[model samples]
Target: MTTTVTTRTVRYPADGLTMVGHLALPAGTGRRPAVLIGPEGPGLSDAVRERADALAELGYVALAFDINGGRWIADPQEMLARALPLLDDPERMRAIGHAALDVLLAEPRTDPDRIAAVGYGTGGAIGLELGREGYPLRAIGTVNGLVTGRPGEAANIACPVWAGVGSEDPIMPAERRDAFAAEMQAAGVDWRLTVYGGAQHAFHHPTADHEVLPGVAHHPRQAARAWQDVLALLAECLPLGEQAGRAS
Candidate 1:
């Protein structure tokens, strides 16, 4: 642990909604590559904020962008009520993500040229839409985002993408996964997917307090392992430390 990670709350506008995002800064940093994080369908939580802090420990500026109007949803139905409609609207999704990106960009310590995005569930979908809208991300990643987007629009993605899902995730069946993979291939996207056996939806959450459906549960082992994979994705794409070397 860096032991000196600092965080701040930011409020911004997106899609006519006032959004709140959390920013985590690394210890002893010059300008560094930035990461934008999207939360699960229920919205931002300690889980997502902790992920941002972890990224800070890795020496990157990280923002856990808020959807769900800056509040956590405890009811599964409520989560779907808000998330589904946004998921259906690509432009709206991109708008929300772009607002968060702006927040990341405004920071003096963030290197705008080297940025990536990672999201869970609905947030993951938003991150993909950000790429599909040509956000200049170095990489995009999602975990169980229920992948499938507007037809023929994926060609706009300009960065590598990584996605993970549970093998038993009913919300993301094999066919949908296949479709997402096919879309990426057709678009010439560098993409990869990892399916963790016996895990269910939201397995990376690390706690059951957020679980409102039997279909979703957290797997600690898988969560730790998946974080490693996400870290590797960032290292390969943004390389926070290497950006300074390259700049010099």
Candidate 2:
């Protein structure tokens, strides 16, 4: 099937700053299920746009969000400097993400009831925050995302969660992963954690540099698997169609 994908630059407020987002919409006649794609560190990149394209090809409207106020940081220290504060400010991140959600839901061709979110790196953290705040998403997926923030954050998530990580990731260790899994279980959330063998942080990035982030490498096989898993989760949890009682 042929699909059309369009990109638009939109702005939202986050932590008192204006954040820009690149939204990708699937072209068709009726409303389509939507997904919020959170950005990886270094803000919006070509890799993110490709991901948006991939999602749109799968028949979902995806918005690749801009964090860090649309600024790019080439140095690892600079990136960390900007990311650290946002990671600690979960509430603010949630507000920003929710604002983006509002934009997506307001789209004329988007199905608000069947919304979901997927994030990478800091973006994943934002997705987790949104899930914890009880957003009405059918599912949430975090790819190699950090597991810091708060312990009570996962308790309020009402939908299914899929968390993918690298087995050799030092940033998010095995203990932390176990703790996160335990918290999700205690919160009664349907959750799955997949650790890809020999994969490290940011394994999905096609342009990832192992020198910048040691032990963090990208594997095409793992990335493809993760993408397929996300698609399956979305299909199972957020199918596109009208309900019997809904007015047409």
Candidate 3:
């Protein structure tokens, strides 16, 4: 079935930076379950747009959020410098994410209770933060996201979470991954973490160059698998069509 998708740039609040995003809605929808997609780096990219389209094709209203003031950082060091501060201030980051969520919820075609979040890289961390902050998401998905903030914060999460990371991700080591998982377990949160062996950071971005991260290499196979897992989890929790119904 052919779906209608629209792209626009929106400014958040007064004096806040303008965010460029794409909104995709399925045909014949009063209000549909929405998926808020966070970008991997400083801003939105075409790759993220493709993912949003995929979600929309599955019968959802998908919004790809731009969090970096609509600027692109092609340099890894520059990107890190910009993202590191966000990791340090979880509250501020959460507010930014919450703002984006508010935008999604405000959309007339979005079902507030059935909203879900999915992010990559820094965006992944934002997704986890939103989930931990009781954002009313049906499910949350994170990819190669660093663990920030205190472990106890996981107690606030009220929905199932699925996290995907590369076993060889230099940015987020395997030991840290285990520690994060342990912390979530201790907090009694329903969470699952998948580490793809031999894959590196940004493995899902086929166009990403290895030189971009020096030693990191993208594994197309693992990336494909991770995408499938994310979609499956969302489907299980949010479903589509009449199955979604009205979120309670």
- In terms of TM-score, the best-performing candidate is 1
Provide the global lDDT of candidate 1 against the true structure.
0.87
Q: What are the RMSDs of all candidates, in order?
A: 1.9, 2.2, 2.4
Candidate 3 lDDT score relative to the true structure: 0.79
Clashing pairs in 3: none
Clashing pairs counted in every model: 0, 0, 0
lDDT of 1 by residue, 1-248 (tens): 45478899999988777888899998764788899999988889998998999898888899999996778988888888988898888888988988898899999889889989999998899999988888799999999995777777789999999999989777888998999999999999899999999888899996653347877888888888889999999989988558565432
Candidate 2 TM-score, C-alpha based: 0.92
Task: TM-score for candidate 3, please give it.
Answer: 0.92
> Per-residue lDDT for 134 in model 1?
82
lDDT against the true structure, per candidate, is 0.87, 0.80, 0.79
Off by over 4 Å in 2: 146-149, 241-248
